[model samples]
Structure formats: structure tokens, C-alpha cells
Target: MSVPSKPWDSELVAKWLEGRIEAAARDQATADRRGYGAEDDYDKAAAEEWVCRSLRTTARESEQAAFALRIKQLLDQEDYRITGIHDDRRVERHVRATLRKIAKMTKANEGFENKLRYQ
Candidate 1:
């Protein structure tokens, strides 16, 4: 079951990226103040890369979280029979797996989506 995403909001992404970039700047400043020398530049680069990766992961997780909440709202409004699933644990597992799959697909499709012109 593919969950189609709403169109990407450039403003929302820009806001989120702004925060991440500011945090990275702060991190670099802290490292410099701690006497990071030439040899540590590599480590600094690696740390910055990690921060960027973390930001991307966080954005993906947040999207998944929003999707899951919407699903829950629908289930509640429609009065789905959770008991019919036999085990609540199984249903919970399935929900988690579905969210993970959605996150993965979002990341995988990001590059292709970037190439398209919306307007």
C-alpha cells in the first residue's frame, strides 16, 4: 500500500533546513573554540556530515510520524475493528513497518522528485 505524499512544501523544508544549518554552524564554532587544529579538520568534516545525515533522518522520521497520526485519526473516525486483527501486537508491528516503508520510499524518490518542474 503506497501512501502518496502531498506536494513538497518548499517553505516548510526551508524552515527546517534553516534550523539544521544553524545548528551545524554552532557545532563548528564550538569545535573551533575547543582548539580543533589541522588534523582535526577531517574529524570536523566528518562531524558536519553526521549532522547533515541526522537532519535528513529526522525530517524523514517526522514525515512518517505525521503519516501515522493521520492513519490513526482515520482508524478512530471510521471505527475500525482492531480486535478482528486477532492480535493488537501484530497490528502495531504492521503500523511501524508501514511507516518505515513510507520513510524509505520518500528518501528513495527524493532525487527523482527534485528533477521535476511543478510549475
Candidate 2:
């Protein structure tokens, strides 16, 4: 039940989010140049689609970070409760199982999941 490592790095994710937001803004400018029924209107539609996708990506990353922080908080509380326990591996396994159960019980996006890896 151990949480697997996430392929996406938080710092890298943050950078990409920032880049996407900037791109979305820039695209908005391109999209604004055309009026209704004008030629090159497709650019505006495409730009809007990109903006929506970028916003969704941002939301996903934020949610993943919040979930990770929640897991860390749960782990910290568990550690505090199990002071002086000598069985480190067993303790970790139990903690992992508990965290997994809690995570699964929580609501999340239907088709998306993020792993919580210990640093």
C-alpha cells in the first residue's frame, strides 16, 4: 500500500503552470485581434481551448499538492503517536496502509490520481 513516486516534480510542475498561464495570456491577445465573423477567428477558439486546458492543469497540480500535504500531516501525527517504536519498516508499512485507505476514501477526480512519495 506504499505510495509510489510521482513522475512529475513539484518544482517542474510549478514552472510549467507558470509558463502555461503566460502562454494563455499571450494567446488571449492573439485571440482578441479578430472580431465576430472575421477571418482568422479559428485562432481565438483554439486559444480559448488552450486557456481552459491550462486552467485545468493548474487546478490538478494544486489539488495534488494539497493531497500530498494532507498525507504528510497524517504521517506526522502518526509518528508522534508512535514514539519510540523500534520496528521502523513495520511502522512505515502500517502508516502507508492507513494513509492509502484514507486517501481512497476521500473524493478526487474520477480519472486522475497522484502518488505521494516520501522525501
Candidate 3:
């Protein structure tokens, strides 16, 4: 079974859930002619599920980046690596990854979600 999260993060989780719901609505609408009545509530349920999944995924990724930055900084400070390592391709990949990380999975808190921003 999944473990519980802290109460302090409830708002953030709620926002995530809203986004998921919106996305699910769009998806379901596209998938079938008939839907489970109560379109609004169905969207809300999708959002809640999304929020739970998102918090776990994003937080874990952020932690990894934080760890990598710390490691790189420490290594640089040590003046080690006489030979070439972490080449341009490797560095570029991480840079792109870091940029993507900053984009966020949703803008649900702004009262929009599931759909791309400005949708």
C-alpha cells in the first residue's frame, strides 16, 4: 500500500489533483461519446490522482539533481580530475534535464490544469 504524505503539503497536492482531473476530462472526452455523468467531478478525481503521483515523481527528481549539483561542486572544489571526464555531451544532457525540471508538471495552482498553459 502507498504511504501517507504530510498535511502541510495538502494545498500543493490538491492543486496537482485538479490538474490531473482536467487532463482526464479532456482525454475521456476524446476517447468516448458517452462519459460517466458528472463531468466536473470526474475531472476532479483525475486531478487528485495526478497530484499524488506528481509529488512523488517531481520531488524524487529534484532530490537527484540536488545531489548531482552537490557532488559536482565538491569535485570541482577539490581540483581533481586530471583527465577529461563528464564530456560536453554528458554536460549538455544534464543542462537540458535541469531546464526541463524547472518547467513543472502543471500550473494547476493558477486555476488551470491538465491542458498546456494558456489552454
> TM-scores across all candidates?
0.32, 0.32, 0.25
Ranking by lDDT: 2, 1, 3
Model 3 segments beyond 4 Å from truth?
Answer: 1-7, 33-119
Model 2, span 6-40: residue lDDT tens? 44344443444345445545544554565344323
Clashes of 1: 0
Residue ranges of candidate 2 with Cα displaced over 4 Å: 1-8, 37-119
lDDT of 1 by residue, 32-117 (tens): 56663532433333333333333444455455445344434433442223322233444444444433443454443333233222
lDDT of each: 0.41, 0.42, 0.37
Prediction 2 global C-alpha lDDT: 0.42
lDDT measured at residue 49 in model 1 versus the true structure, 0 to 100:
34
Q: Candidate 3 deviates by what RMSD?
A: 15.7
* Total backbone collisions, model 3: 7
Stretches of candidate 1 exceeding 4 Å from the true structure = 1-3, 37-119
